[model samples]
Target chain A: MPLVNRVKELRARHHLTQGDLAAKVGVTRQTIISLEKGSYTPSLMLAMQIARVFEEPVEFIFTIEEETE
Target chain B: MKRVIIQSLSSIILYILMAFTIASFASTVTHSLAALKSGVFVLEFNFLPFLLLIIFFVVWTIYSFRTRPNQQMGFGQWSVRMTEFSEVDEREALITAKATKAAYVSFSISVPLFMLTFFFYPLFQTAWPTYPVFALVSTLIIANLVYMTTWIRAYTR
Candidate 1:
């Protein structure tokens, strides 16, 4: 199952730019971009950091999608 | 990103320059020794390559240290950083690890290829005395190029 994330949507809801979110989580903007593009799965620490920044639960921000194929 | 690219290119140039410097220095000393043994007593030497090598080494060292990630030396002290070895974040660290593996693979593939070229060394010994020197240098150059290419590709992709 692929890990799906609401990083982009949550970041927008929180009125934060990619750079702003990355700054809060101590990662590069590229990492944030990759995360939003669904090309990278954040580590547990990073996922927690993102959830903390967005004031959401880690489970709410990230979930495993059911495999369809 | 631009800085990283420039750093890779500069390192390639530095490796090539080092090869030329070593080859020239070795050739000069060998020829001088041969001439002296044969009672010719000639001291023909060229300092241009050596001087250029020194100048470029200094410049590259300064540029590398300035642009590369600084590793904390403890208690507010810092020193020179090795590229692809010290990174600022997890993604960068992962990329460096991949690049390092690429370099190792290239080195493994290149050494045997260079060694194979050694069989032909005897044929070109008189005509190209510096063939082995170049072959050795080329191995290092190829490994570095592969590492840089892998790193750049990972970053872009």
Candidate 2:
């Protein structure tokens, strides 16, 4: 299974640049970029912070896709 | 900015001192090795290199502590922050890890092949010195280069 995220979509909806969101969340822009790209998974604290920034639940931001046999 | 400049200068000085110390030690080691090869037992002890290494470490510690992101941050946290700022971020770290794994896999496969080739070298009338130290160092360098290149490409593309 792979994790998918709506970080890029949410950022666009909020009219926020990756750098803007990253600054608001006290992280580097590259971390946001990685989140959007689904290359790195954020910690629980980071996920909650990001969710707060977007005013959404963590589940709304990230989801896991089950592998098909 | 001023502090950064001072830190940079100090770092440069420490680096130069370390380099000089290493060079001197290398020369001494080479001389000793040559002497040993010529059936001469000449052992000399020099503590300059060790002292320089300690000084270099002290300089690094001072610089790291001075440039730490916050007073509340512990040394480990400060070190992580410094590395994150100077080196890769999350994405690059992930890519680097993958690249390193791939490099290790290739290295494992290649080493035995290389050894087998060396084993067959005498049959081919080829004379080569099987220096394990040199071979190991070169392998490590090549593996690191491969990992770096792969990591960079993965991120850039």
**Best candidate (score: lDDT):** 1
The native-contact fractions of the candidates, in order shown, are 0.25, 0.25
| Residue ranges of candidate 1 with Cα displaced over 4 Å | A67-69, B71-80, B84-86
Report the lDDT tens digits of candidate 2 across residue range B1-157.
2333344445445545555566566657866898999999776757776687787778778767876646787887676542212223444456657776867876887677667756766665323332433344445545555655566566544
- The digit string of per-residue lDDT tens for model 1 on A1-69 reads 788889999888889999999899998998899888877777899999998998899998898887323
Among the numbered candidates, top TM-score falls to 1
Give me the runs in candidate 2 sitting further than 4 Å from their true place: A37-43, A65-69, B1-92, B120-134
Summarize candidate 2's per-residue lDDT along A3-64 as a digit string, tens digits.
Answer: 88888999999999998998888777867876787877877888898899999999988788
Once model 1 is optimally superposed onto the true structure by TM-score, how far is the C-alpha of residue A49 displaced, in angstroms?
A: 0.7
TM-score on alpha carbons, each prediction: 0.90, 0.51
Native contact share for candidate 2:
0.25
Shift of residue B88 alpha carbon in model 2, Å: 5.5
Calculate DockQ per candidate and list them: 0.62, 0.25
- Tell me the chain A TM-score of model 1: 0.93
